[model samples]
Target: MAEEKQKKKGGCLKWGAIIIGVLILFGACAAAMTGGGEDTGDTSSDSNEAETTETATEESTEEETEEATEEVVEEESPDAGIGEQLDVGAMSYTVNEVTTASQVGPSAFPTTANETYVVIDLTVTNNGNEAVTVDSTYFKMIIDGATFDADSAASMSANQNENGEITNSFFLENLNPGSTMSGKIVFDVSQANADNPEKALQVQEGIFGTNSGTINLQ
Candidate 1:
């Protein structure tokens, strides 16, 4: 009986040792798996954060670029919606009628390349106490950003037999204070510009080219 008891105790010890070994191996595998999971999770979190930061930076840059472009466009564009009342020096001027003609009277004056006549009927009142000379030099036309001087010969030819103290031409005239003179001023321009009156501009300068103001015909 003593021998059997001893044998049984020995068997118990062996089984205990086997169970302890199995437990140790299981714990080691679990630790390795947990460590690997932690590493993978950290790497994935870092990658996501980097992607988010990069996307935000790109969006901000694009917004800034768009805003800058808009500002540049605004600055480069010309002013629109002119052509109202204008006071230059001591003279107040008004452009009442504007017309375009392919031919002046029965004959067409000789012009350089693609030229056409533009007639503008204007009324000028001298507000100053002294007389002021209103001449062709006071008027200019801007087309497609290019300026053209008034054509005196063409204007004279257009209003050849027209009667009135103030002839139908942009004749050099002296106006006394409170007196108003109304006449037409003619200009020679390219047909390309005449075709697109939306791009035409009229500029008037007061005595000695002072107090200039612009009117947009378009």
Candidate 2:
């Protein structure tokens, strides 16, 4: 009976050890699974953050591009009209009147136009401190996207007095500061453009001055 009891006790001890080992293995597997899940979650979070940063950067670049385009469009000013003051470089001009004529000058020494004469009566003020030389080339007529130069011959006749006397004051003329001169600038244009309401004058500071302003002829 003693030996049998001892054998039974040994059998219980063996079974208990096997059950403890199985429990320990199960706990280890559970810990490994939990750690793996945490790693996967951290990786997902990092990828989301990277994507969000990239999206924000793209949006900022697009906004900047749109602002730059708008700036370029606002640089152009509107066109000026008759009797309005326009300044280009150092000269300020005002177109008082615009007329059309087939001929000009005295009857004894008159000059005829090829098509029609578009005359612009204007007053120019020497706004600068220094004197500037003025010429007929300082003015041009714009018609139908084309520019026509002043007709110097007809212009010379137009500048004459009633006695058929012409003065060189309007040619290579020197304008003093604070002084103003009024004259008619003539442009020979086609018959169609002479009556067109879309004509304008491109007035400049000098014959070749890059800075210019436009005056609506109508």
Candidate 3:
């Protein structure tokens, strides 16, 4: 009877140890699964945040592009009209009259055009503190977006005096402040160009054509 009791006690103790070992293994597996689930959730959250940042960056870039395009459009707006003074760096230009003619000057000493002549009578006022030089080359007629130089030979003939001599006003003439110089600038352009709606005359403060502004035509 004593031996049987000892065997029974040893059997119960061994079974209890095995059951405890099984419970410990189950706890370890559950802990590992919980840790792995936490890591996966963290990775998913990081991926969502990265996606949101990328989307915001794309939207910001698009908005900046739109603003840049708007600024460019505003910069290309139309210029001023005729009879209005366009002020540049140190001078101001005003178109008094615009006429188209097949020829200029007196009939005996006429300066005929190849197609037609666009005569622009304008006034340039010196607004600077010092003096500035004016020349015929500083003016250009823009017709249908095409630029045409002033007809120098025709201009000399057109600006002849009552005695049939040159006036030399549109040449290399020096002007002081509060002084105005008026002359006719002739462009030997085609009739189509003279009658174009998108016409403008560009006047520059120097011979290099820098610091210029335009006067639009009808």
Candidate 4:
């Protein structure tokens, strides 16, 4: 009976040791699994945060670029007032008038003799804002399909002439704005040899031939 009791106590001790070892191993495994799960969750959260940051940065950059482009366009645009002034400069013209004729030379000459010369009076006004100076020599008269140079025309005064009819032949020199200049032209026209009254006094406006402006008899 003593030997059997001793054997039964030894068996109980072995069983207790095996149970303690199994419990210890199971606890270690559970802890390791939990730690691995936490690491995976942390890595996923970090990746999401990084992606969000990159998207925000790209959006900010695009907005900044758009704003900068708009600013540059505004700065480079021309002022409305300046643009209007430039338009006015391109369409400017001068005003001119032909004056009446006066008698020259001896007034008592024989009726048949061509002693009386006709004069033309011209007044030119500059309507532009710029200063202008015009030369009388550039002017000519077209009478009855015939062109009369300024040099050949007789003159009694700077702005008065003995010619019965005349027109502008040339436009020379710069005419300043808001200024007036006067000149006279003279011609010797016999009543019989005179050209058509209407066509005799034509004036040209520009420097180029056939491209000049014409003024009808007043």
Candidate 5:
């Protein structure tokens, strides 16, 4: 009976050891599974962070490109008239007299005996504060009923003769406020035309001083 009792105790002890080993193995497997799950979660979070950073960088680059394009368009646009604005003022002219005589020299006298000459004294006055320049090339002298060119009249006489139809060029560099300048114009008139000449000599539409003015040559 004692031997049988010993055998029963040994069998109970062996069963207890087997149960303990199974429990240890299950706990180890559970721990490994938990660690693997944690690693996967960390890797997923890192990937999401990288994607967000890339999206933000792309947005910033696109915004910069749009701003640069707008700046270039603004710089190339036209703004306003690119020239100096001229302010014109009032002008007046007066014809003093018309006469036949040479004041420059005797050598300038016309070689032709029938050719006569006349002088027209003009007084041009600027009433405005602005300076004015005139192109006197357009000036023409009218004697009797004939028109004479200004440049050709210069050859009539070497003397300063103010007779006949002639245009005079005077550079009144700057005609300040309320300033006046006097110049003489000579015209070549035939002796026959000068005889009993009703309107012996007259100046017409030869004075265009400025863009703005009622240029009266009377």
Candidate 6:
């Protein structure tokens, strides 16, 4: 009987050790599963943040592109016409009339063989509080993309008085506030170009001054 009882106690000890080992293994597996689940959740959060940032960056870039395109369109708008008020800053000008002549020299002056003249009747008004100077050098005639300056001497010699008298040339004059002056500018060009001049003329207020844009001459 004593030997049987001892054997039974040994069996109980062995079974108890086996059950404890199984419980420990199960706990380890559960810990590993929980850690893996936490890692997956962190990765998902990082991915969502990255996606949101990329979307915001794309939207900002699109807005900037649209604004730049609008600016370019405004800059490329077409200019105004002749006999229309063109204000560069403080002064204004208008081309009242345009004429082409076979030749324009002193009443009895000789003419060039292949040269002709284009005259522009201009009116300038000083809109500023102070005086401003208007010079013929600031004017140019564009013919087939070519630019020509006014010929003041030849212009003064043309359209003379009956006694061979000459009119005052329109150049280098000061205009006071609310004052208006009307005069003519003459340009010598080839006969072919004079007959078919460019459709626009350029008027400026100073050397390298602000452009009043191309005025329609047709």
Q: TM-score per candidate, in order? A: 0.53, 0.72, 0.77, 0.35, 0.37, 0.70
The residue-by-residue lDDT of candidate 5 on 64-93, one tens digit each, is 999999999755422111121112336555
- The local distance difference test score of model 2 is 0.85
Model 5: number of backbone collisions: 17
Candidate 6's C-alpha lDDT?
Answer: 0.75
Per-residue lDDT for 177-201 in model 3, tens only? Answer: 8899788888998888988888898
TM-score of 4: 0.35
Write down the lDDT that model 3 would get. Answer: 0.84
Encode model 4's per-residue lDDT on 31-130: one tens digit a residue.
Answer: 9999999999999999999999999999999999999999997554222211121111222222233333334333343112244344555555656656
Better candidate by TM-score, 2 or 6: 2
Q: Point out where model 6 deviates above 4 Å.
A: 1-48, 66-78, 110-114, 143-146, 158-168, 195-198
What Cα-based lDDT does every candidate model obtain? 0.70, 0.85, 0.84, 0.49, 0.52, 0.75
Cα RMSDs, all models: 8.5, 4.5, 3.6, 17.6, 19.0, 4.1
Query: Residue 31 of model 3: what lDDT?
Result: 100
RMSD from true fold, candidate 1: 8.5
Tell me which of candidates 1 and 3 scores higher on TM-score.
Answer: 3
Candidate 4 segments exceeding 4 Å error: 1-3, 79-218
lDDT of 1 by residue, 1-218 (tens): 99999999999999999999999999999999999999999999999999999999999999999999999975542332333455765767677767787656423333332367887767778899988777877787877678888887766665554332236355677788899877767787877777676644444445566456665665
Best by lDDT: 2
TM-score of 3: 0.77
Question: In model 6, what is the error at residue 160, expressed in angstroms?
Answer: 5.6
**Candidate 5 Cα misplacement greater than 4 A, ranges:** 1-89, 102-114, 143-145, 151-177, 200-218
lDDT of 6 at 185: 76
